[model samples]
Target: MDNLKFENILGWKVPEGSLPCWVISESERLFSIKEKKPFYDYSPCCYFKITQRLDNNFIEGHLGHSEYKGKRFHDDISTSYEYFSNYQKREPVYFSFDRVSLYRLIEIIPNKPLSFILKRVDSPKAIKPNRAFMIMPFKIENLDNFYQSYIKNYLKTEFNIDIYRADDFNDNDIIIETIYNQIEQSEFIIVETSHPNKNVFFEFGYAVAKDKEIITIQNTEIEKNLFFDRAHIRAIFYSFDNIDPFQKQLEHY
Candidate 1:
């Protein structure tokens, strides 16, 4: 992207026959830029509600209008609305954000003009959710499954907010940095208090200091050990066999 030059991002587009084009609004555009800070100038009630990130120079997430003019994205990113939007297909697609123009404000429309500047990369085993972060131990039985299948699905479906845990990403070279990044990106957090982990507490403490909306989840069987009481937030206790109580309690948040 450094080599390619474009003054304005809106004028950009995915390349011809590229994985697909995802014309991002001003909000998604802010994420692609380095210096500017306003998320989006205009959006239709954040209806599309999707997220994307540039990792290893590749773009990942529900690339097509997760900012949905539709339900899901297909290979022809230009189309594929009104279907199950599954960017979480166990494997993630990686693409690149490109620019064809030299100036932000200037448009050089050729005889055959095109704007999309995204390139597809065949990367695998990576899924990212930017809205919420989960801080729980990986060692817990079926806990990861509960998060991925039940919790992640519910939040994305009900609230359009995607949740991710540290283990969700295949890469953890700089584990602490990644954890901090997720915390910073998240609008809220769902942390576990059952069978508490020290590192989890440390991260939770950092989030508290940052003034993030924190929600705790714990198994009913485990006693709350050295409970953290900050901002008067309490943990939502649920049973693995019955998640009904947790679902009902989450609305209070």
Candidate 2:
């Protein structure tokens, strides 16, 4: 483990000099973003044509370009699990999904603006996997139901994750310390900015301070504006419709 805390890499935007990854549709036009990856040279932007938007947030698309080919195995641990076991290595390796969609990663061209796009062609379904983070909006009086339902769905749907609450923690003494410790260690934070609650605001501030990923969702215009001021802080905003879209947004991250 890198002993480094997650805060060490907050707001680290990808350099603008980086190239774009193309997502092409079947008609030979390019549009729609499946995900983004680091840029690499010698790898042209791959293309995929949208075939259908399957129910349950799964999409079906056909691959148009083969410059960067094959579906990615998102789980790096499984790919390396046997190798590490054979070597008797106990150290955990850090994997970056941000690099998965990049092309020519195996080889790099020095200093050129490099880009790679992974296109989806002829895939039966574009799966919208549940994000590791949970988003809870407090205005819904059924806080307990909302929290429980999210946890249950994630567990039932086979999503592996780390969960953290952005509010309801006492700021004095051990409670604050314990909450901070948990947030510090978490991979994601859920902000319930439904009512502009002071506690939720504090929690959001802490998440921003620590540089952790956040998922902010609310139903009203007022709540959206409340979070709008903190655009400097990176987060995915959801206006109901489909929670899966927010999940897709996180997949890109």
Candidate 3:
């Protein structure tokens, strides 16, 4: 980004010896008047919003939807319109201010030219959402069928989140690795501490190490002997009749 050069910022009213700030405004192009103190030159299309930063990087604000005209931008100063109109689709008009970063401007600008300049602005590597998460419930066998049914049914109904059972683990490390990776990326995790299996405890610890937000539930009575910190991590205490309570706890998770 340091190697890239940007045009200029508009509507910046920065005091000398200050950092940059973002603002919305009506009209004014902010720049170094004498390469020292800043000033504004009000023009015809000078109606735009301006926010001042300690420094001089100004982000131009529009009141409403606008069109990226060939050499100018057309926007309303009252409300944000539904969508901006189409322009001649020529080169983007870059207001001349000095403090804004080129990469940031590229992101804010529309109709940017596609070439080496754009390649530097748009990074090819980025993460995508919509990946599925798998969950594994511990002590599945020890729990009564009613309890198992309650856990599975409530998880899907309340959160609409899914998990794969640890029992599904095959001899393939690739499968296990994929499952673990998905868990690390999951938005929320649930670990049933009910009559814990060794693997479940390991999974719980792994989830904690990964800093995954977790919801812990236990069917057994809360153990006073457990460390206070561990007890604090528990999200819910559930029994046969306490399904509603469990659901309530998960509703906000």
Candidate 4:
């Protein structure tokens, strides 16, 4: 339970382009981002691919690569739960991903020059299914009908998960604190991107940089809504009141 507040900085000119994760100031909670370069790494990654933490200061890529080429499990916990195994790299100009892809991960470590053309392969999914957090627009109509009556119950029943929704709380003082706690504790996150909600997207970006399991739900594809929305992430597109198919697509999890 590392309840430490994340570090944030202002006036940072992140290398221009499609960059998402490592470029983020050391921690995922950093709020101010300055766009400097014209590059974004939407490269694809799968299991057994090279990887590393994005915030590593070293200019190399050899810290958290696949070890023993095997998965780890715990005796007390169920193996059904997936984990985002630690994959921090540094050397030869280290880089990282937001790890926000729906079904796959995009791991592209560049050379000292920061050119991400070295290895563009698919990386396996990293997840911890024990806990999940939900983020959505706060001012939506019929809030109870849209969430409590439908989404919440449906998810709890289908996935048998322990979920934490932000709006469920009434303490404004603790909302941000709880949010940080919930996001850190939750193994996966259910983001409602149905609307161009900056709060929701900001939280989504936080989850991406933290390397948490992300499950995004959107009414439609609004490319303009998300500044870091160029990558291919598995999104469940559904109309309000229709959730049958949403359950089906979640099987990919």
lDDT of 4 by residue, 1-253 (tens): 1112111221222221222223222222121112222123333221121233233221112222122133321112122312222222332221334332111123333433221222322222323356688888776676446667556776678767767788664342124544755675577888877676788878888788877778777664333243356246656765556666766776566
Instruction: Please give the lDDT score for candidate 4.
Output: 0.45
TM-score of each: 0.48, 0.37, 0.41, 0.44
Q: What do the candidate models score in CA lDDT, each in turn? A: 0.50, 0.38, 0.39, 0.45
Candidate 2 local lDDT, 1-253, one digit each (tens): 1212212442222122222123222222111123321211122232222234344223333222222223321111222333224223432211111212211111111212222122222211112233233434455655555555544344445455545453543232124433544555455666656665676677667767877777665544345554447655555555444556655664565
lDDT of candidate 3 at residue 208, scale 0 to 100: 85
Question: Model 2, which residues run further than 4 Å from truth?
Answer: 1-140, 166-173, 226-228, 239-244, 250-253
Best by lDDT: 1
- lDDT value for candidate 3? 0.39
lDDT of model 4 at residue 25?
22
